[model samples]
Target chain A: MKKLLATILILSLVLTMAVGCTSDKVEETKSLKVTSGLWSRPEEQQFIREEILPGFEEEFNVKVELEVIDNIEKVMEAQKASDEWTTDVVMTHSGTMPLYIANEYVQPLDSVKDSLDITFMDAFESATTQDGKTYYLPISADVYLLIANQKALPYLPDGADVTKLTWEEYKDWAINIADAEGAKVSFPLMPIKASQYQVGGIGLSYGSEFPMINSPGMLSAWELLGEMVKNNAILETSFNYDNPVEQMKSEEAWLTFYHMVPVGDIYSSAPAKYVVAAAPAGPNGNGSIAGAWGVGITAGTNNKDVAEEFIKYLARPEVLYEVAAGTGGFIPPVNEVIAQLGEEPKDIIMKKGLDTLENGVVSGVPASEYTDWGAVKSVFDTVFQEMWDNDGELAKDFLDAQQKELEKLEK
Target chain B: MKNKYKKWFPYFLLTPALLYYVLFWIRPVLRAFFESMTDYDGSFSLMFFSKVINESMFTAALRNSLLFALISVMLQFTVAFMMALLLNKKFKGSNLLLFVALIPMAVPPAAVAILWKTGFSTFGWINNLLITLNLIKEPILWMTAKGYNALLFLILIDTWTVLPSVMIILLAGLQNLNKEYEEAGLIFGASRFQIIKDIIMPILKPTIITAVILRMIAAMQVWMISVMMFGYGRVPFLVERIAYYTDMVPMLKESYKMSLTYSVVVTTIVMISVMIYLRVNKKKEKEVRI
Candidate 1:
C-alpha cells in the first residue's frame, strides 16, 4: 500500500514538472515576425537568417520569423483591410512609408527614435518623418552612380573627367564609345525595372524641379537622351535591360548610371575591370536620386514592445553595418555605421555614392509628395518611348500634353 | 420518397462544386466589379473606368491585345491544324515527331521568353549561326524591333510556346475520326486536299472551335512573353497593363482601382469575343442545316 502511494506521488510530480517545462518553453520561444522587401535576394536572405537575426533572437529570447518578399506593400495593404495583423515589423523602400503613413498602416516609432543612439542622415530622417511624427527608421541609403567599363575609359571625351563629367561631356563620351565600338552605354529601361529616377536625377542636375514635367532642365535632360539615342550611343538592348551587372560582365554595355548596389555587385566582382564614379553633373550640379530603405512596426501588431525592441536592435550600429555590408554593400544611413566601413571594393563604391549625395543635388522619390507616383513613372515611360521611337526628338508639344496629364493626376 | 431522393441526389453531389464556384469565382468577380465602380471613399463612381480609358497606355494595350489575339489565334490554328493533320498520318517516326513537337509545351512561359531572348540578342547564337553560314557579315540587331515588329516577334515566340498544346487537341480529334470517311472521299475520286477540305473539315469543326477558343482566350492574355521579351511600354497589352498597375505599382492609391477596372475591361472583351465566335459558328451551323 505504501509503494503504490509513493508511485502515484512521484508520477504526479513528474507530470507537474513536464507541464511547467512546456509552459517555460512556450514563453521562451516568443516569435517576432518581420516582413521585408529589401535585401530579399537568396544570399541576402540567408545572411539575415544566419548572421543577423540569430543574435537578436538569442538576446530577446524570441524567434525571428523573417519573411523576405518582393510584394511587401501588397501584403501590408491587405493587412490594413484586416482586423488582425500578422506582421510585427515591415522593412521596405523609404518611398512606400508615406503610403503606409497616409493609411495609418504603421504606428509612430517614437520609442525607437528615443532609444537610438546613432544619428541618421537628415535627408533620410526627413523622408520617414511627417508632421513631427516619425513613421520609420531609415536603415540604408542608395544613390544612382556611374559605372564604366575600363575598356570605355579611352573613349572619354577630350578633357572630360570620368568622375565629374558634365551632361554634355557625358553625351560626348557616349558618342565617342559608340563611334569606337557599337552602342555600349546602357540604362535599365525595362518596364517595372525602370530608370525614370535617372531621368529625374538628370533633371535635377539641369536645374529642374523633379516631378515637374515641362521645366527647361527636364527638356534639356530629355534632349540629351534623344541625342544619345539618335547617335546610337545607347545599347540597343537597353529597352529590355534591368540590372546591367550581367551586361557589364559580358562587356555588352561599357557605361551605365545604375543603382549603387548593382554597381557594387559588378565592381566588387572585378574592381579593376570597371570604374565607379558620381553621376554626371549639369548646370545645377551633379544630380542624384537619393533613395533609402526603412523599417517600421505595423499599427495593428500585437507584439508592439517586442517590435519596438526589434527596431531598436536593427538601428544598432553593428547590426546596421553588418546588414549593409552583407546585402551588396548598401550605404548605411547611420553616421556611426558609415564611419566603420573599411576600404573594401564595395565600400569604396558606397563611399563614392555618399560623395554624390554630399556634393550633388539629391532628389527624393516622387512618392514622397505624389500619391500616384506610378502614373508619374508611366508618363515618363510614354514620353521616353516616344522620344526613343522618334530618334531622340525633343517633342515639346508632346511633353506639354503629358505635363497636363501629370497635373490631372495631382488633382 | 425514393424518387424525391433520386431527384435531389445530383444537386446534393453538386453542392460542394456550387459552393466552390460561388465562393472562389463568382465572389471575386462581383467584388472586382463593385470595387472598380467604387471610389476610395466607397462612393459609387465611373471615374475608374473613364480613367482607365483615358490612361496613356490604354489604347496601345487594347490594340496590341486585340491584334495579338486575332492574329495569333488565326495563325496558331492554321499551323496547329496542319501539324496535327501531318502527324495524324501513320508514317514511320510519327510518334517521335509528335514527342519532339510537344517538347516546347513542356517549357513554361518565362523559360520560353529566356530562350528566345538569348537567341534574339544581338550577339546571340542565331547571329553566330548566320555569321558561320556566311549569310551575314555583321549581326542583325533583333532586339531593336519597335512597334508592330515587336508585336510580330512576340506572336512568333508565343506561337512556338503554345503550338504543341493546340496541335495536341486537334490531333486527338483527328485520331478519333472514323477512317471510313477519308476512304469514302478517296473512293469518290477526291484529291487529298479535297478530302481534307470537304470530308475531314466538317467533322473536325467542334475540335477546331475548342482549339481556337482556348487559343483565343490564352492569346488575349498574352503579356508575359511580351514583358519578358521587351519589357512594359515597348509592347503593352491589356493584361500587361493590369500587371503594371498591380504588380509593378501596387502602392499607388490609383493602382487598385485601375487594375480592377482593367480586369473588368479585359473580362468583358474576352466574353464578347467568345460570344461573337459562338454566334458566328452557330450561324454557319444553321446555314449548313438549311
Candidate 2:
C-alpha cells in the first residue's frame, strides 16, 4: 500500500508539471503580435477605436494591435527583451525620452521630417532632442498657475499685485488669509516626485542660474518654505494632486499653485466662483516649469513609415487643437494654436494658462539630468515628510547629501 | 520479467520531474551564483559583484528586508495560530467564517494594494471615522510617513493578505492531531491550557515551523507591496532596489548582478530557516524516542 501511494504521488507530480509548462507555452504562442506600442488614457480607449485606429488602419493598410503597458520602465524593458520590435510608437513624458535615446531604443525623426507639415515642429524640436537628433514630438503641454477662491478676494490688500509677489509678500498674504479663514488658504505640501521636471519651477523661484539643488537660490527657497510652514500657510497633511480643485470648490483654500488641468475643470464647472491667474513671480522672475508629453516611433519598427506619418498627423495644429479641447483640460503646446484661441470664449483661467506657458521658464534640462533621480527623490521625500511632520531641521543636510549622491551620476 | 518491468515503470514516471528540477531549478541557481560573482554587463565579468556590494543601498535594503520578513512572519504566525485554535473548536457557522477568511487570498495583490492605498489616505474613511469620534483633530498621513510607520503599514497589509493561508494549514494539522493523547492528559487532571502546552503544541511544532519558514521566505522576497505602498527607494527594500536598477538603469550587466545578489541573500535566509526547523525537529524526535 505504501509503495502504491508513492507511485501515485510521483505520477501526479509529473502530470502537473507537464501541464503547467505546456499551458505557459500555449499562452505565449497565442499572444497578439504588434510592431508598435500605443499608450493612451483609460478614457481614450473607446475614442481610439472610434477615431484614432480607423484612420491609422486606412493610412497604413495594416492591422496593428495596441499594447497598453502602463509603467514607463516596463515598456522600455519589453522593447529590450523582445527580439522582433513590438512597439512602433510610444507615448511617454519628456523626462523619460533621454533614457530611450541613450539606449538607442528610439529612432531619430529627421528622415520623415520633410514629408509632413507640422505646425509646432520648431517648438517641439527645441524640447525633444539630444546631441542634434530629434527623437520625439510634443503631443500636449501642461502649465502651472495660481488659482484663487472668489470668497477670499475680499481679504486681499487693495493694491497687492497677485501676479508678482515676492516670497515674503506671498507668505504674508497666505498667513493673513489663513488667520481670517481657518484651513482656507494653503499650498499643497505633498510634492509630486514622479514629475521631476517640476523641480525646475522651484529652482527658477530661487534665482538659480542652473537648476541645481545645492545653489543659494535653493537654500533661499527652502527658507521661504520653512517660513510658510511656521506661519501655517501650508497644509499639515499632503494633498492629492487631483483633489485641490475639489478643495477649492468646497472653500478649503483661497489660493494655491496648481496645474492648469484641475483648475480649468473647476472654473468651467463654476465660472463665477473661481479666478485663475499667472503663478506669482519669484525674486528673480515669474517662472514655472512647462511639463509636456511626446510621441516617438520605436526603433527597428517594421511599420516605421506609417508610424512617422501618424506622428506628423498628431503634430498638425488642427489635430493639436482637437486633442487639447476634446481632452477638455490640456493646454496646446503650439504657439499658433494659443494665438488662435483669442477668437474663443474669453475666461480668466484660459488667459492665465496662455500667459503662463508663454512667459514661464520652460524646462531645458536633458532627460538624462540624473540617472537615479527617482531613487534620490524617494530618499529626499522621506526627509521632507519628516521635516514637515516633526518640525525637523535636516532639509539642508539632506539636500547636501543628495547633491553629493547625484554628482556620482556625472561620472 | 514482471518485477523488472515494475521497477523500470517507477523510474520512467520520475524521469520527467528529475529532468525538470535539473533544468529549471538547479541550472538557474548555479547560473545565478556565477552571475553574482561576475561584473555582468549584458554578458559576464567577475567585478560586477564587488560593485553591487559597495553600493550603500545594498546594505540598507538587506537590513530593511530582514526586518520586514521577521516582523511580518512573526505577526502572521501568531494571528494564524490563534485563529486556527479557535476554528478547531466545533461551533455553528464555523465553516462560513473560514470561507469568509479566505476572501483576502482570493483578492489579487494589485486590487488589495489599491484598497489599502485608498483606506490609508489622508482624507480616507479611516481618518474620517477617527475625526468623527474625536480621536484626533486631523488626518494622519499613514503611508506617507517615513521609517517605522511606513514599514509597519506594509507589514500589517501583508499579514492581512497572507494570514488566511497560514491558518488553513495549521487548522488541518490540528484536525489530524491524535485526540487520545490529549484526552489522556485531561484524564490525568491536567488543565486545558496545560494539556495544550504539553501535548498538543509539541506535536504541532513541526507543522508550525514549516508554515513560518514558508511565510518568511515569501516575505523576504516582497516587491509588489513595497512598490505599491512606497515607490522605489522610498521604502528601500532589497527587491525594490533590484527592480528599480533593472528597469531604470541602462547598464544591464549591473542590473543582472544586483538581481543575482538579491536572489542569493533571499535563498540564504530561507535555507537557514529550514535548517533551524530540521535541527529542532531532530531534537524533538530524539526526546520522544527516549
Candidate 3:
C-alpha cells in the first residue's frame, strides 16, 4: 500500500511538472497575434519564417503568432464582431485601408510616427486621408506590364519597339507574331472575376484615361480590349499570373500582358524562355495603375508598441529588398529600397516597370466610396462575360445599367 | 407530492432542449421578423425595410430564388428517385456506385466550385473532349451566358451535390414500404409500371412529401452555390442578396430588413409545404375509411 501511494505521488508530481513546463513555454513565446494576407503564399511564408520573424524576435523578444487570413472582409468582420480587436497587425491592399479608417476599426499611427523613423510625412502625403491621418505602410508596388516570349521577337515588324508601341501597333505586332508562330497572344479579359489583382490593373489602365468610365479615354480602352477579343489576338482565358508564366515557358503564348512581380519568378525558372517589358502606352500616355500591399497595426492590440516596431523592421530598406529580390517578382514600394537592390538583369527589368509606377496614377478614390467593390466586380464580370458572348456592344449597356445601380449608393 | 415530482421530471429533462431552441433559433427568427419590418442595417433602425422593398434588385432576387428553388428541387427529386430505385436492386458493386454518388456531398462546396470551374474552362476536359470528338469546332463558353445558362449551371451543381441526401432519405422510405402490396399487384396481373404507379407511389406519398418539403427548405437558402458560381447580385437570389446587403451596405437597418424578408419568405413556404402535406395525409386517411 505504501509503495502504491509513493507511485501515485510521483506520477502526480511528474504530470504537474510537464504542465508547468508547457505553460512556461507558452508564456515565454508571448504569441503576438498578427493578421495578414501577405503570409498566404509559400515564398512569403518562407521569408517570414526565415527572415522577418527572427529579426523581430531578436529586437522585441516576442514571438508572433501570424494568422494568414484569406479574405480581408472576413478579417474585418471578425475584428468588428469581437470588439476587442485580437489581432496586433494587418496587411492588406492599400485600396481597402480607407474603409477601415472610416469605420474606426483601425487606430492612427500618429503617436508612434517619430520614434520609428518612418517617412510618414511623405508616405502620408500620398496615402493619407483628407483628415491628415496615415493608416497603412505602402510596402510593395505591383505594376502590370506586357511580358513577351523572346522567341516571338524575331517575328515582330522591324523597329516595332514593343515597349512604346501604340495600341494599334501593339495589336498589329501581336497578330503578326501570333500568325508567324501559330500561337496566340493572351491578355486577361475581365480578370476581376478570378483575381482582384488583374481587375485593379485593368481598372487602373481604364481609370488613368477616364478616371471614370464615361470619358473618351475609357471608351478607347474598352474599344481596344473589344478589338483584341474580335481579332482572336487575345485568348479568352483567365489571365492568372501563373497561367501566362506557364504559357511562356511552353511557348504556347507569344506575348501577354501580366503583372511584373510574378514574371521575375518565370524569368528565374526559365531564363531563356521569356523577357519582361513595360505595358505599351495607353492613349493617355503609358499609364499603368499601381497596387500597393502594406501592413497596419490593429486598433485595440495590447502589443501596439511591438507591432509598430515590427512594421518598421519590415519596412527597413534591406528587409524590403531581400523580400522583393529573394521572392523573385515583387518590386519594393520604397523607391530607395528598389534602387538599393541594384541593377541585375531581373532587377533592371523590374526597375523599368517600377519607373512607370513612379509617374503612374493609382485609384485615388477612398475606400468608403466603394464598400462592396467585390459585389461591383461580380456585376461587371457578368456584364463583361455577356459582352464577350454578344459581340462586345452589350458591355456598354451593362456598364450603363451598373453605373445607374452604383449611383444609388453615391446618393 | 411524489406524483407531482414525477410529472415535473419530464419538463425538467426537456428544459435544455427547449431553452436551446428559444435562445438559438426562435429569438433570432423573431428578431429577424421585427427587423424585416424596419430598415435595420445591422443595428436598430425602422426605415430600411421600405428602401429594401422599393429596390428592384429585391424583387428580382425573390423571383429568381423562387424559380431556382422550384426547378432545382423538382429536378433533384426526380434524379434522386431514379438513383434510389437503381440502388434498391441487389446488384454487384451497387454499394460502390452509391458510395461514388455520395462523393460530391463529401467534397466541400468551395472545392466543388473550383473543380467545376476547371471542368467548365475553355481548355478544360469537357471542351477538349468535345473538340476531339468533333462535336463542336469551337469551345463552348459555358459560364459566360446570361439568364438560363448561368442559372442552369448552378442548378446542375446544386442537384449533383444534394442528390445523395435525397436518395438516402427516399431509399429509407422505400425500404420501410411492405413489398407484399407490390407482390399483390404483380399476382393480380399488374405490370411493373402499373405496380409502381398505382401501388408503390401512393403508399410512399407521405415520405415523398416529407422529402420534397425538406429539399425545398434546403434549396430556398441556396446562396453558396449561386455566389460561388455566378457571384452576388449578378444572378441574384434572395439569400445571396441578403448576404450582399449585410456585407456591402453600411446601414444596419437595410441589412436587417433584407435578412428579415428572406426569413419570412422561406419560413412561409416551408410552413405551407408542411400544412399541405398534413392536409393530403388526412385526406388519404379519410378516403381509406370511406
Candidate 4:
C-alpha cells in the first residue's frame, strides 16, 4: 500500500511536468492566431522565432499564436457552424486576393488604416485595393530576373546586353554560346516549381498573357526553346531548377532565370560568380512576373481590434526591414523604406530587386496570372516534360491544350 | 433484466468504436462520393466522372499506380520473406540485424526521399564513392535514367523502406507455425524442401496474403520518390495527381471528383484483390476435426 502511494506520487509529478512542457504556447486568454504562408524556408526561422514571437508578445501583452500552414482551404462549413474565425490574420501572396474576395475570408483594411504609418508603393497600393477599398497591407515585393555568370556574357551576340536581349537575340545568343564554347545555356525547366513561372514570363515577352501560350509570339518562344533542345543547347544541369545556386557553383549552368528569392540566395553564397539583370523585353513589355505578398485581418476574428493592432505593428518599416533582411529576397513595398534601407552591404540584393521591381511591375489581377492556386501546374509541367522527352516537338498541340486548361482556371 | 443487460452489453462496449467509424470514415467517404458527382454549386452530374475517365493524365497515372503496386508487392514480399527466414533461424546477432533492418521504417518518407536524391546528385556521395573505387570513367545520370532502370531504382528504394515491416509480419507467421508437423515429416524420411512446400506454405498462405494486401495499399500511393528524384511532371502516380488537384490546385469541384474517384478505385481494388486471393486458397485451407 505504501509502495503504491509512492509510485502514484511519482507518476503524478511526471504527468505535471509533461503537461507544463506542452503549455509553452500562448497562455493568455486575449490571444491572436496569425496563420501565415510565408515560412517556407529556413530563412524564416530566425525572424519568426527570435524577433516576431517575442516582440509581438511583449508589445501587445497578448500571446501571439504564429502558425505556418502551406495551404489554407476555404473553411465554409466551419465558418458557418462556429460563426467565428479561428484565425485573426492571414499572410499570403497576391494570387490569393481573388479567392479571399470571392470567399469573403478577409475584411477591408479601411478600418485599420489610421494606425498604419508607412506609404505604399504605387503598384502595392493598387494591389491591396479592390474597388478602391484597401483589403490588405503589402509585406514585400518580388519579381523574377536573370542571373548570369560573368564568364558566359562574352558569348553574347555583338553588343547584346544581357538585360536587354530581344527574343531573336536571346535565341541566337544561347545557340552561339552552345556552338562556340560547347556549353548549352541553362534554363530552369522544373515546371511544377519555378520553371513554369519563368515560362509565364517568357510568354509575356512574346505578347501572350497568362496561360500565355497558343499565340504567335508563344510559337516563336517554343520554337526557340525547341531549337535549343534539338541542338543540345540546354545543359543537363539547367533542366533542374531546384538548386540553381549549386548549378552556378558547379558551372554546369552558366545562365538561368528564377525568382529574386533564389537570386539573393545564390548571391549571398557567391556574389562574385553571377550578376543580376532585368529580364529582356518582349514585343509588348518587359515580361516580369511581379507580385506582392501581404497580410490581412480575417473576417472571422472575434477581437478585430487586436488583429488590427498586430497588422499595424507588422506594417512598420523597421519590422518590414527585418523581414526583408530575414527571409524574402524582395523589394520593400513602402516608398520611404526603400530610401531608408539605402545600399548597405546586405541591402545590395534588396536594392537590385527594387530596381527590377520598378522596371516591370505588373499590377493587381493581371500580375498574379493564375488567381488562387492554378491547378494546371502539373499538367503544364508534364506537357513540357513530354516535349523535352520528344525533343521539344510538343509545340502547337501541347501549348493549345495547356492554354485551354489555364483559361478554364482563369474563368 | 440481467439477461437483457448481457445482450445489450456487447453493443454498449462497441458504441465508441462504431461512433468513431461513422464520424471519421463512413461520413467522409460518403461525403466525397456525393461531392464527386456534383458541380461546384452542388448540382449532381455524371460529367465529372466522364471527364476524369477521358482525361489522358488521369488514365496514365492510374495505369502507373496499378503497375507500381503490382511490382512493389512481388518484390517487397519476396525480399522480406527471405530476410524473415534468415532471421527466424535464431543466429548470433540476429536481434541486432533485425534492429538494423527496421531502421528505414523509422525514418520519415520525406527524409528518405531527400537522402536518396542527394546520393543520386551530380557530385553526390554515390559518384564520389564510385570515382574512388575506379568503377567507371564518367558519372551516371541517375535522375534521367529512363525506362526500366528508373523503375528498378524506385522499386529498390521503396522495397528498402518497407522491407522490415513486411518481414515482421512474415516472421510472426513463421514463429506461430506448429513445429510438430515438420518434425513428423522429418521422421518419416520426407525431404526438407517438400515439407516447406506442402505443409508450411499451406498454413502460411493466409498470413502471406494479409502482408501483401497491407503492402499493396502503400505501394499504390508512390509519389514522393518520383517527385524528389525525377523532378516535376517527369513521373506521375494517381494519388500524387489527386493531391496536386486537391491541395496545390484548389478547384473545389475537380478536387472533390478526384478524391471520390481515388477512394472508390482504391477500395474496389482492395476488395477485388482480397476476394481473388481467398478464392484461390480456399481449397488449400485445411481442417482436421474428425
By lDDT, who's the top model here? 1
| Every candidate's TM-score, chain A alone | 0.90, 0.77, 0.82, 0.84
Please provide, for model 4 over A94-193, each residue's C-alpha lDDT reduced to its tens digit, 9 standing for 90 to 100.
8666567556778899867756666888776655778878788888878777777888888888878886766567677777878877544667665456
TM-score of each model, paired residue for residue: 0.86, 0.78, 0.79, 0.88
Better of 2 and 3 by TM-score: 3
- Worst 10-residue lDDT window, candidate 1 chain B: B245-254
Q: Write the per-residue lDDT of candidate 1 for residues B206-258, one digit (tens) a residue.
A: 99999998988899888889888888777899999888887776667788889
The TM-score leader among the candidates is: 4
B1-290 per-residue lDDT for model 3 (tens digits): 99999999999999999999999999998887776665424555645555656776777777777788889989998999888888988799998998898888788777777677667765667888999999999778675545767777888888888889888888888888898998899899999889887887788877788788888888877887666555555577877766776655434324546666666766776678668767887898799779
**Candidate 4 docking class:** acceptable
lDDT by residue (tens digit), candidate 3, A129-187: 43877677766666666777777777667677766655566667766765665436755
| Per-model CA lDDT versus the true structure | 0.87, 0.67, 0.67, 0.73
| Model with the higher TM-score, candidate 1 or 4 | 4
lDDT of 1 by residue, A226-270 (tens): 889999998878877777876787788999988888888888889
Classified by CAPRI criteria, candidate 1 counts as: acceptable
User: Which residue pairs in candidate 1 have backbone atoms (N, alpha carbon, C) closer than 3 angstroms, thus clashing?
Assistant: A226-A392
Query: TM-score of predicted model 1?
Result: 0.86
Better of 1 and 3 by DockQ: 1
